[model samples]
Target: MAELQGFVFPRTATGRSSILPAPPWHYSGDLLTIEYRTDPERVIELLPDPIEPADDPGAVALVWADWQSCSDTFDELLDPVRAQYKEVFFVVRGRYQGEHVSRCVYIWVDKDYALVRGHYQGYPKKLGSIHLTRPVAYGKAGPRLEPGGRFGATLAAYDRRLAEARFTITGTADQGGFVNSHAMLHTRFLPAIEGAQAPPSLHELVTMKTVDVDAGPVYVGDADLTLFDVPGEEFGRLAPREMIGAYYRQVGATFVGGTTVHSYDD
Candidate 1:
């Protein structure tokens, strides 16, 4: 007979801490993205100073992803459900410091654990329901299988449809030369404690950070996007002029650290 050890773990307001685990967090999964051209004026209105919309057709990309993520501290291999979840994000292409970059405008996830983890990394993630449909085969099995298939996903918040997208898979290709941009930028704000006389004149601060990813094999495809009536005005502005392209791919990244590009006091 095996004996179990009884131990108590520290807890916070949210739950157990998943941050102190360690480095080299591994995330492997499929990402289906739909790209759309938008008004350059609207894109400019959304970007902060030192960031400008890309010269090539100002575009926004929506991504639907299902991942199996783990870290050195918590090998999800032991319990897959603990680390597996679905996510969706709306991003815009922009330029920073003379380099093309992508900035996340909004993001949603189905799990609280993922929400906490993303927030710590400066990703503006919010709690929502995301459903990503797996790729389905179209024809016969084996070598006779059709060259293309289909993928789809939907995102909802507050019991309302935020957005939904469908993609027609064409074939697989190298991760390079794809419309999917790898560089990302986000802003983080630390506000001064209100009515704290002891702290005196401590200033509120805001900072911008960028994250770059090296993607793996990419699946090329065509996509269609449907934007629904959401609470935010920004969501309405994202209505696609036209879908430029779409692609699917498996991704892996080691989130190390970020550089603070800008800071402002309240």
Candidate 2:
């Protein structure tokens, strides 16, 4: 029998995937997190049907991270370049079924694998340049996790700066200060290739599932953000109206996959 097999794309006879490895992908990273209040109407526009704005309708968070990731084999750890990537995302609060959930509106990642992996989990992921200040124990100019620490992060695509953030740490914070204290909502959409005028072949509301999740200590701070009015991007619509909170934290988690909550096809 002749066959080709793999969990991801470009399958081989030996069952080796060309782009991504097997499941249970793990990640550890340092993040610069910022929370703010955007326009309520803007939030309404981004959230899909049946998911209305939460009590704090205009509330949102943007996070920039420098990450190190690996699959089951964890071989990428040894080849650090393969494992290192940076990403930034914007998440808004929505109420679904009387329950609060987080919805990621826009996200940018540095690596192709990270983009593809994020797409699988229903994130609206795009490729971009993401940078953040990495904290060090001996850093004197700022970029430390302790009090008075200052960090900066930036996101850019197509040679244009889209957004940036700066956080100045005041003290330590608990999980409650974290923006995503609840589950996140997403939409997995695969457009139809069979027909030029056909609708998306796969479209569904979904929620991600993570295993061995660790919520690391958070550094609370005053945050400042700027969203550039890019010619082609609509993310600027969610421009900050009021700064809410900021954080610097370390996180570790595994991407186990997700479950569909609703199918538009039905």
Candidate 1: tens digits of C-alpha lDDT, residues 1-266? 44322111234444345332444566777788887777767777777777776776367778888987776666676887777899998787677778777777778998876776676565778888888766544544312112466666899988889888877667776652333464666666434467544443322212333234456666777777888976752577767887677777767766655656655442
TM-score of each: 0.78, 0.94
Which 10-residue window of candidate 2 scores lowest in summed lDDT? 173-182
How much is the lDDT of residue 254 in candidate 2? 94
- CA shift at 104, candidate 1, in angstroms? 0.6
Q: Per model, how many backbone clashes are there?
A: 0, 0
Model 2, 1-266: lDDT tens digits are 76878777888887766678878899998877788888899988888898987887888888898999998999999988889999999888888899999888999999998998888888899999988988888747546678887788889999999998777889987653435677989999888998758989899999888889786787888888999998879988898888888888889999887888889988
Q: Alpha-carbon error at 151 in model 2, in Å?
A: 1.0
TM-score of 2: 0.94
**Candidate 1: where is the Cα deviation over 4 Å?**
1-22, 136-146, 175-180, 195-216
